[model samples]
Target: MNLTERLAAQPMSNPRADRVKDVAGLAGRSARSKRGLFLAEGPQNAREALARHLESPCVDAVYVTEDALGRHPDIAALLERVAGDRSVFVRLVTREVLAAMSDAVTPQGVVVVCPSLDVAAEEVLAAGPRLVAVLARVQDPGNAGTVLRAADAAGADAVVLTAGSVDVYNPKTVRSTAGSLFHLPVVVGADLPELLRAAREAGCGVLAADGHGDVDLDRLQDASAARAAGAEGVDAVYDLARPTVWLFGNEAQGLSAQEKALADHRVAVPVHGRAESLNVGTAATVCLYASARAQRRGADRP
Candidate 1:
């Protein structure tokens, strides 16, 4: 039977059903880890999850309220397409059921149960990625997610969270990623030293973003621009146009001395304003885009 037909035939109305509780349990790290699954809440997340499912079949099931289906026909259509040949189950649920399965204050009427999407650190490095973001002991799920989203926006190849970092599958982190979680590879529980060594072996320079860094980000950008323009005698500190791995740290403590030392260079974002410091997310965004712009400009150069 078609997904729409099946959904109509079995409308799930119980908010406290065992099945609903099982899906809702994914909000907890233990449940997500034990089950090897996580929840993708809201229309955007659902859409991205389903899109990924089409390529990889990671999604297990989809639950949506009729109101949400009506409001977001694109999601409904994608669900139907994903369920056509796969075991991806689609269920129509009441608003209460969706709310019960969600961790949001106001549920967005749809949730997708998907397997953990993290890949191995070695695999990411093996791919010879041009840009990567490594989070070392970042405790806040929101900040981690925001950095992941920013990295995706900056066209980064992957994001790696170190061993002491917050759970990337945390509900708040998932929400903060919006749909970017599905856009690039994310590696969780990575050994920072090992990953940095692997990155260097793969010919990628590692840079730590620090408030008191020795290298100024603006100067690197200017130097990169000069080289791109074929200017004579450009004294570049570090080549921003080359493959790079960015190390970001905790939102509160920033990077530890040891963590900063692991990187080949420490890059600081210039602060012209009166603000004390830039947040981790903002700093990561600026740093990543700088590398992206330099790399792109170099790639486009004759």
Candidate 2:
């Protein structure tokens, strides 16, 4: 039977059900680790997860309120498409049940339980990616998710969160991704030094985003632009068009000396407005887009 038929047959009304508690337990790291499952709360996240389910069947089940289904026709349509698939379950729940299953303050009426999506660092490096973002010791869940979203927007091949970083599956981080979590490959619990070594071996130049660094981002872009335009006698410091891995450090302390040492060069994003500094997410977006522009421009060159 399809989702609509199943919903009419038996709606989930109890907030205190064992099944509801099992889904809610995913908010805790220990429970998520044990079950290898995570919650994708809200319509935005649920839509993305459902779309991915159509592609690869990563979603385990979907729980939603009738009001939410009416409001988001796209989500409802996607759920109908996957309704017949035995691997994915769809259930209609009360608002109270959805709230009990969500970690958000104001739960958005839809939630999906999905398996962990992180890939191994080796697998990503083996793909010969041209652009990568590495989060080293980034502790804030919001910062981590924002950087991942930025990387996805910048068309990065993958994002790696090192061992000391926040859990990629943290509900705040997952929500912060705003559906970008399912858009790209992410590596979690990676060793910083080892991943750097692998990236270097894969022919990627490692650059660290440092606020106090000597290598200026503006100069690199200018050099890249000059080279792309076939300017003569333009000696570039480091080619932004080359395959690169950008290391973004912690929100509070930035990259430690040891982490900085692992990169080919430390690049500073110029600040002309006299603001203290760019947050990690903003800095990562600027740096990733810089490389993306340079790379695309280079690809267009004769």
Candidate 3:
């Protein structure tokens, strides 16, 4: 029942053990899907998973290294707080065993097994979210994760990954999120057209980020500012403060003409420098922040 006993009880020492292989198997989508579990590696992710566990008990177990415990006393304390839960499992392990269970060359010495983070598209849309980011067929894990984090930082109510997008549970994607994965609702494998239709029905104006669009990002900001400053009705060409969904696409291909056409408007993020374009994450960050700022400027209105 004490700390010492808990630490020694389930010592995971062998990298080749079947148990270790089972944990490492979670790195693959099929394995994760079959077992209904995935891995959250490193200290920050473990803490975030536990924080969510406190709310819903989705974390199945935690495996950690002794060195990691010494370096991160916070992880030690966190494990202690959750130790009493009969449903949760915590174990001490050799660094090699921890490494074997992770994709990282030098594992963070902590990994938590968690159920998939998917909430239904309905759950994300149920509240009629004011701001959202939609990733359409985005193939890169890092890009997806960064956009997720950016969306969270900009106070987006939800993020949706269309059917062909990278898995949010991909280890690289999870790492890039830097714990923002736990900060907001993320819906995966959604049908883009249906999702957009739902958003429209929920009073959301969909905007696609495109380079050749007629609407310029600077112009949109200017219009929002003018409206906030009590400008006449017609001067307000676009209302960024209103409920909106931002549509973003793959890093290489960008949004297709068909995809851009799904939105009520196609807005361009102007390129001032000679650079060709902004990557998906940067564009999403700028777009979401614009929405957040304008939405917060309600003081200038009623």
Candidate 4:
């Protein structure tokens, strides 16, 4: 007699259910922004979100077809309860229409509209000793998404994209996050100087990556080692677990001289390959993982 039982027992007729086919045609970011809503698609992620947050009634609207109901039995009940409201609809979309509506190439035949979490920079930093990846002017959506995934995997406190970075909500970028977008705090429209000042005030050290730097990032094992080196103007060098910010710059030009000057220290990943430099995203993942390694070492030390 529940929603899933109802879905399983009921008869189906409507092929093109009452749902928005072209989500892009529905509204702009301002509308989604003002209403605190964003699109969620695919069966696996949809079911996960429903299982985790929908039971609390946080889910606003859900669009599912009869086929999706049969395929995703786990979420059928949850979807039915949420979809009962007029605001929610179980729409039947043609595979072609769903494909167009979906950001992913292979439409999962299910999608939902839900609330977005507004994550603040200070709140994220306050969570603990921060590991923040500050991405400056990174235009490539894939690169941006890869950096976000890396930040999530590296257990970063937050990821901040300064002005000029690709849109975080762009379907391509969002699709590339692979569900990490939901797990971490992402702050866009960052003010570099303000962030730097705040990190410094919070006792966090800032390290800017440059192909040309005073020291290789692989060298600094811990805060004590960095401090002992006593490199002039290098501040406390870098302790990745000590509320640190890692600055990655544009893909083509790398870090600008002005941006480079803002860091307390410049560090570079040592290269042994034939290539002169790592791709922006590859370099970022390596840098973030290095921080993770250093932090693990710090934690293990008695």
RMSD of each: 0.9, 0.9, 1.5, 4.7
Q: After superposition, how far is residue 68 of candidate 2 from its true place, in Å?
A: 0.4
Candidate 4 lDDT tens digits, 1-302: 44544445544343344344336333355656666676667775577556646444435555556677678777776666555444454555445556555666677777666666446667766666568899999998888888888888998878888977776766566656666666677888788888788778777788888877886776665454444344335444456645678999999999899898899888888898778888878888888888777676656655
lDDT of 3 at 173: 92
Best by lDDT: 2
Off by over 4 Å in 3: 1-4
**Model 2, 1-302: lDDT tens per residue?**
77879879656889999999999999999999999999998888998898888888789989999899999999989988999899898899999899999999999999999999999999999999999999998999999999999999999999999997999999999999999999989999999998989998999999999999889999999999999999988786799999999999999999999999989899999999989999999999999999999999999888
Q: For residues 235-279, could you state the per-residue lDDT of candidate 3 as single tens digits?
A: 545788889999998899999888998998988898999989899
What is the TM-score of candidate 1?
0.98
lDDT at position 287, candidate 3: 87
Tens-digit per-residue lDDT, 126-188, candidate 1 = 889999999999999899989999999999999999998999989889999998999899999
lDDT of 3 at 18: 96
Q: Is candidate 3 or candidate 4 better by lDDT?
A: 3
Model 4 per-residue lDDT at 11: 41
Candidate 4 local lDDT, residue 302: 53
Candidate 1: segments with Cα more than 4 A from true spot? none
Lowest summed lDDT over 10 consecutive residues: which window, candidate 1? Answer: 80-89
TM-score, prediction 3? 0.96
Model 4 CA deviation exceeding 4 Å by range:
5-22, 26-36, 51-59, 65-97, 222-236
**For model 3, what is the C-alpha lDDT against the true structure?**
0.88
